[model samples]
Every structure is written in structure tokens, then in C-alpha cells.
Target: MEDLIEDKRQQTGEINLLDIECLGLINPRNTYAITILIYFLENSQDWSVRQEAARILGEIAFGNSEAINALLKVVRTTVHDELAASPDFTPNLESNSQIEFKQLLISSKILHNKPNLDFRASESLYKIDPGNQEAIKALINLSFWHISAWCTHDDAIELLKQIAIGKPEVILKLKKQLQSNNESVRGASAEIIVTVEPNNQEAINILIELLCNGGEILEETQDFFTGKRILEHIFKAIVNLPSPL
Candidate 1:
């Protein structure tokens, strides 16, 4: 495994999906396995390899603080890099302005240049630490801002529902996002809340409003499709809600 990791470092084609799968099939509790997976996750040039490493780390390194911290670093760095690559990004801005710019860019990036390593890392972090605020926030951003087909908005929302089960703070954050000006953000947030808290009248009301009145926030050319997607989320949530007394 160490040799494979080295070969991956020196040559991208030397390692492939089979190598990652073999690594995953090893005893997850093996310390060397954790170390090798972390190395691949942090150093590999191949995003797919890194994503697999992240997934395995979550499965094996459940309570390992070192592994959790590494996943956190990946999420933070990936998100910052994605935002920095935005066309509207400006360097040397004031601290507050930079922060605001990040928030704005989070909701408006139509094209995601980077792979979904950050999403995979954040999902792993959630598996390790459900209460991790950074992971929850990253998932929220991916749910709303990321428009890729590989990592759909529903993927993030489904994960958030699991994380929000007993985490009030996560629920609160999702509820707050329901009020976001971005219609997609609101719809995504509501979907999570309703899925987690079926009796959440506020979230149910918002879903109804989004279904009836929400515009296509995903794209102008794909308005009908995107709006239909949001409606699908609403219908699914409503169907799953408890029957009237």
C-alpha cells in the first residue's frame, strides 16, 4: 500500500480504481490503512482516488480526531479554492468584503470547475462527526450552490436530513436558509427540514410556496426542468408527511 501510494504520487496512471477498491476492502481498523488512505486523500492528483480515500476514511477512522481534522481541512481548502476561482472573485479586498464575496459566490456559481471532492469530504466528516458545523455548512452550500449532475442537490439534502435528525443547530441552520433570497436555497433548505421534521409547519408552508410561486433559480434555459425538480422535492416531502389526525 505504501508503495502504491508512492507510485500514485509519482505517476497518476500507476494507480487506478482497482487499487482504491483494494485499499477499501482491507481491514478498515488497520492503522496502516488509515495512514495510506489519508495520504492518498491529501496528496493524490486524481480526484476520484481522493474521493474514494475520503469515503474509506469515514468508514474506518470513525473516532480518529486526526482523520476528522484532515477531512475538515480538505473541505475548507476545497471550498475556498472553488470560490477563489470564480470569475467575480477579487483579491486584496477588505476582510468583510471578502467574506461577503464568498457568501455571494456560494449561491451563484453556475459552473463548478472542481470535482466534488469537497462534497465527498464533507459527507465523510458528517459520518464521523454529525455535529460538525463546518460539514453541515459545506453540505448546505453543495445542496444549494452546486448544480452538477454527478453530485445532485438531492444528494446533499438527503445527507443533511440524516445529520439534522437530533442536531438542533443543524436544523436551525437549514431553517435559516429557508429564508434565503435564492429560491433554490430556500427549496433545498425546506426539503431537508421537512424530511427531518415532517410536522414542521414552517418548512411545509415554504415548500408549498416554492412549489406554487418559486422561479427557476437554477438556470434560465432550464427553467421548466429545474422548476419541475423542485416540485418533485415538494411532492415527495408532502407525501411522506404524517397523515392528518
Candidate 2:
């Protein structure tokens, strides 16, 4: 196995297209085993080779979400911040250098973003209806390692909207967070979704429920993270909720 991997790597270095073809044949769908493929996809000195790797990974990951996320991590880490300062936001140009800069924004997020792949993988596995233990195990690892960074309250709320559409049960998790003691987490958790889309009835209902009937949540005036209107937004949400009391 290592011999085959070595040949593929060496072949790419030598600019051997035949070797590239062989590598593709060897690992048509098994990116997990084709670590050599990712190595080239990620770190080849040649832009053409790297581009080819990126292209192939895109195709490979179409059905296997694990492959997709693995590639996403590569994209995230290799993202060039200096180049991404003003993202194109052009609506579908995947190779825009601005994407490299977007990683900076991911770190700047006001709330936490968990990319560890645990939650991601579990969710993907469930979506595929794989119905087994291996998928759960993969998801757990994915979460712990990759997706566990902070996001803007905007990003979190946007994600919640996406989640709310597919899995209303996930709203239950957001519902629990609306009652949190930490002002930032709770405020961001509660208002993030409604602020972005404004049609989150369940989320809005939970926010109302928290403000009117939930326990006393102390307010802290310190600015913990920059650039997020998480708490101020939460206060607004509180005032906006209709009262039965």
C-alpha cells in the first residue's frame, strides 16, 4: 500500500500524468486510504497539481460528506488571510482568493463554531441513514478536532436557521441555550437566529418564553468579544417579545 502511495506521490513530482491516472484508479472513492491523493491535493509545489487535487476532492466528496469536510478543513487551514481581506461574495466563484481570507472571519465570529466533525459527521450519517456505530464514531472525532472554533453570532444564527429548516429537533438544543447563565452565550444563542432571518417562530417563541417566564439571567456589561451585537440584540429581543404577564 505504501509502495503504491509513494509511486503516486513521486509521479506527481515528476509531472507524470499516467501516475496521476493510476492514483485516481487506486483510490476512486477511498480518500481515507488515498492519503497520498490529499497530500498532493494539499501541498504539491505545482499549482496545476494542487488545482487538480482540489478538483478531484470536490468530485470525491459529493456523496461522502466525510470527504467533503476533510477537504473543507484543508481549505480552512490553508486559507490565506492576507488575500481574503475583502471577499468577492460573487455568488459562486469557488476559487476566489477572497475565500482564503474568509478564514479570518471564521475566527472572528462572536459565538463558538464547532467543526470537530462529531456533530457534523453524526448529522451527516443520520442524513445518509447509514444506521450504524462507525458513522457515530467518525462524527465524534470530526467534532472534537475541526469544527470547534468561535463564529460570529450572525454565523451561529444563520446555522440555526439552516438547522431549524431540516431538523426542528435541533431547535430544542437552541431552546435550552436561551436559558444559559452567561450573557454572551445566551444572548447570542437567543437572538442570533431571529436577528438574521426574523421568521424563526420557534426560536422567537423560545426567546419570548425566556424573557417572560425564564429565570433571572444576570446582565454583564463587559465586552468579551469584538464586533458582535449579541447582547444588545438580546435586550432588544426581550423588549420586543409580546407580554401575557
Candidate 3:
């Protein structure tokens, strides 16, 4: 079967044979299938084939370090900004060729939006091991738009509480972002700070500063209140903080 695949590759210059092989190997119990997929991933000339191999690797590898390592190798080598000579590079191609091109396009968009394949790999790793700190930190390094929604949720609040206790430096990173010239960055930093440390004097002082000398405050409309009064939220947080001794 391996020789047949190599012969087909040499004749057709495509990975259709390997694609079929990968489909058969999707079962988690098939270790040899995983090994073959990793081989294709590492050595396939066509990146689209490599990408399909990556997806399957993420699925079947689960918590397997060997699988994770192969995927991470792909993640490291897969340049995100790679673009075809034309956006519509599928012209005059066979069905399999078109499929491969489409896969390449998907891979490009995934990397472009998420910033890197490593981030995607980390997400997959996290799915495999929820407590993987490396995965957690990798996800945390993503942009606010990528990693968080605008509104606070119970899970997010709980996570913040946990991070405050175990990894206070994660909270401190927000303080560094406060110095950013971008108002969105500054606003988000202040907002999360207040959420995490409502009683913290330093956080309160920063919020007060934002309220007094505002550039770009996050605006939210709650029950007919439509204004950029982030300071009010800060004030309310201060008011709600437990009274001092």
C-alpha cells in the first residue's frame, strides 16, 4: 500500500492516495494510521494534504505527545500568510485538486485570523488536556477580540478569580496594557481590572483616572442608558466594594 501510494504520487503529483489513506485512519485505535498521517504531514509536498493530515492528527492524536509533536511541527512550519497567485486558484483543476486548494485556503484563513497555527494547535491541545498550562498561556496570548467577548460572564468571572489567586501576573499584564495609546486597549484593561479587583486601590485609582480623563470608553446600553460613562461603572464598583475597617 505504501509503494502504491508513492507510485501514484510520482505519476499523478497529487496526494489523493494519501487522502484516502487518511480517511481510513481516523479511528483512534489505529496507531499505524496515526504514524502514516504524521509521515504525510511531515513530508507531503502539497500543503493542502499536510493540512488535512493536521486536522486528522488533532482529532485522533488526542493527548498523544507523538501526535502533538507532529502537529506542533506542522504548526511551526505552516506559514500563515502563504497566498496563492490567485484567490481562485481552482481553475482547470481536478476535483481532488480543487479540494486540496480549498483546504489550503481554509488553512490560510485560519492562520490569518488566529495569528498562527501554534495558537490553533494549542487550542487542540487544550481540548485534549484541559489543564495544560502551555495551552492556556498560548490561548491567553491571543488578542482580546480573539480570546474574549465584550460582556463578562460567570465562567469568565470565575476564571478571573482563579487567575488572580494563582497567576497574579496574568492580571498584571492588563496593567501593562493600560499604558497603550489605543483607547480600546486602555478601556479593556481598566474594565477587567475593575472586574477582577474591585477593591484594589490601584485598580480604583486607574478607573478614576479613566473616568476623569477619558479618550475612548467602552460604551454599553443597558435598559435605555446609552452613553460612554465607563467611569460610572468604576464608581459603582468602588461603591460596591466592602467598606474599609
Candidate 4:
């Protein structure tokens, strides 16, 4: 795979395989080689390559030292305008001192924009222990959109609430979205009920309120759970903890 990357990196124009090299390192089919590549990316002075490497590491969110360091740089980078990302972020030059063309931001965008791309996190902590809190915590910061509609009902909800505690912006939007007039929002609301409670009392009161209120969500194509099961999930939450986290 790397040989393929090397061949393409020597391209006269934009390196066609630049992204492939980064992706391979992100979630490589091989471990030792990829780890070395990741370290190399982390140490590279070129912000372009560093940015791409950071994005791939961010996807892991497992806080492995090297991966965590790379991702921390990205979290900081996202906040900066022309963030002093890579110490060597310079334009490429051709033989005549003419500016050459090559940009790593494009590749970085794909990886960062889609943190839950799944394949990237393979063989890491997420693969071994799906419930690692650190990774979930990182997702709260970087990957809310993907988590918002994921199939994990209760766990997804909890993660959202945890995130909301720190980021009111995300919570307000998500909660407001929960009751959005859209049918999908109505259905998707179920995904977070277990996880969106701001506090225990609020969670408990909402559960009680929902049960009495039928957990009604605009009465769309389907009645929430199964039409007959309007409040099954919420009711279960009420019955089990009576006050979710």
C-alpha cells in the first residue's frame, strides 16, 4: 500500500495518493507501519500533512498519546483563523521558483468533517471497547452531527447530555430540534431521551411528563416507537432509573 503511495507521491502535479497515504495511516490494514507513519505525520513541519494527520487521529478519539497529541493540535487548529498549524506551512515551488500546487486541507476536511467514518477507528480502543468514555467525550466535541442520528438510542442520548453540560449551544439546538416540526426530528428524538437530561430531576420529571403526555411527537407517519408503543422506551427509563443521567 505504501509503495502505491510512494509511486503516486512522485506525481508531477498534485499528489494523487496523498490522501490515500493519510487514510492508510488513519486506519491502516497493517499496524506497525501505520503507527510509524502516524508518528511521522505528527512530527512533520508541514502543516498540510500535519493537518491531514491530525484529522485522522482525531477520528480515533481514543486519546492514545500520539493520536491524542495530533487531535489536540486539530481542536486548537479549528479555533484559529490561519491557525499556526504547521511550522512549515509554505507554498510548493517548481523548478523555476514558480509556485507549485499541493494542498493538504482538502484531505483534512474529509477526515475531520466525518469523524465517525467508522473505518478510521478500526482496531483502536473504540473497536475493542465501544463504550470508552474518552472517545465518546471527544465525539461530543467534534462529531455531534454523526452521533445525533446514530442508531444507539440510550447511549447516544447520554453522550449528548454530557456534551450539552459543557456546550449549551449544541444542547439548545439539539433539544429544540428534538421537538422540531419535521417528521425525522420527531422520530430521531427517541435516540437521545436517555442521554439528554440536563439533571436528574429534569430527567425524571421529563420522563413522568412524557409518560403522562404520551411522549407525543407531532403524530407523524408513525406514532414514535410502534404506534402502540408510544412511550415504551421512556417508560422503561422511568421504570429502571426513574431519573436518568
Residue 55 C-alpha lDDT in model 3: 57
lDDT of each: 0.72, 0.44, 0.53, 0.43
- The digit string of per-residue lDDT tens for model 3 on 92-136 reads 456696688787776555445334445445555655554566554
What's model 2's lDDT at 53?
55
Return the top candidate by lDDT. 1
lDDT tens digits, residue span 1-245, model 4: 65655566677543432455455556653443346446645455444554454444434334455554434333333323232443333534344422222235533543443333221222133333444444444443332222232332334445454545565455555455455544334333433443454244544555566567553532532433453343555556566653434
Model 2 C-alpha RMSD to native: 12.9
Model 3, runs deviating above 4 Å: 1-26, 43-52, 74-116, 144-245
Root-mean-square deviation of every model: 6.9, 12.9, 10.2, 12.0
Whole-model alpha-carbon lDDT for candidate 1: 0.72
- The candidate with the higher TM-score, 1 or 3, is 1
Question: Which lDDT value does model 2 have at 165?
Answer: 50
In Å, residue 17's CA in model 2 sits off its true spot by 16
Model 3 TM-score on a 0 to 1 scale? 0.41
Q: Give residue 172's error in model 2 in angstroms.
A: 1.3
Per-prediction TM-score to the true structure, in the order listed: 0.72, 0.37, 0.41, 0.34
Residue 155 error for model 4, in Å? 13
lDDT of 3: 0.53
